[model samples]
Target: MDLQYVNFFAVAVLAAVIGVTLIVVHLSQRKLRAELTQLREELALWQKAGLHAPRAVAAAEPDARPSQAQGAPMAPAPQPLSEEQIRERLQQAAGAGEAPERYRHVVTLADKGLAPEEIARVLQVSSAEAQQLVRLAEVGRKKS
Candidate 1:
C-alpha cells in the first residue's frame, strides 16, 4: 500500500478506538451516578432516623475517638440502648424468622460494647459486614 494510505488507515483506527473508549466511559459514569443516588437515599433514611454508632461503644475502644482535635468540643454522645431495647430493635430489623435470631445475636454482642472486629470474630462475618449489622441495629432502634 502507498505510504499515504497506510497513514490514513492508522488515523481511522485511532479514531475508532477513541470513540469506543468514550462510550465505555459514558456508560460507566451513568452506572456510578445511579449507585451514588441509591446510597444517598439510604444515608438520608439513616439520618432521618437519627442513627449513629452508640456512644458507649465508641468510649470502650480507645481508637474510635472523634477526629476532632483534643481541645475541640466533641458532639454529645448518644445515649446507649438497654439490652432489652437492642433485642427489640433486632427483632424489628430482622423480622420474623429463625434467621433473625442471628441478627438478634449481633445486638447482644454489640450491647456488650464489642467492637465490630470482635463482633465479626464471633459471627464469622467480615468486619465491614459486622459494622453494617451494628449500624442496622442502630437504625432499627432509632426508627419509630
Candidate 2:
C-alpha cells in the first residue's frame, strides 16, 4: 500500500511540472505575437502618412505642355552688345567712382567663362546681378 501511494505522488508531480512548462511557453508565444502585430500597425500607419510617397515633377512629363492660355507673353530675347560698348559702359561707371569694386571683378570673371553663381560668390554680388553681368559679357564676346 505504501509503494502505491509513492508511485501516485511521483506521477502527480511530473504532471504538474509539464502543465507549468506548457503555460509558460504559451504565454511567451502570445507576447511575441502581440509585439509583431504592434510593429505591423506602426509600419502601416507610417505608409498611410505618405512617408514613402512618390514625387511628381511637371518637367518629367514630355506630353504635358505648359498652358499658354494665361495672357502672359514670353519675354523678348536680350540683344548682344559689342565689346567696345561693354568697355565703354564699365569705363563710364569707373569714371564716376560709383561702380563697386565687386562689380568689376564679376565682369572680369564672367568674361573668363565662370558661371554667374560662382562669380557672385567671388565678387559678393547678388545672384541676379551676376547673371546679368554674365549675359552682358556673353553678348560682348559674340560681338567682338
The estimated TM-scores of all candidates read 0.40, 0.31
* Model 1: per-residue Cα lDDT at residue 77: 40
lDDT of each: 0.66, 0.61
Give Cα distance to truth, residue 87, candidate 2, Å.
54
lDDT of 1 by residue, 34-73 (tens): 9999768755644554553333433456544444565645
10 residues in a row with least lDDT, candidate 1? 49-58
**Which RMSD values do the candidates have, in order?**
10.7, 20.1
TM-score of 2: 0.31
lDDT at position 136, candidate 2: 57
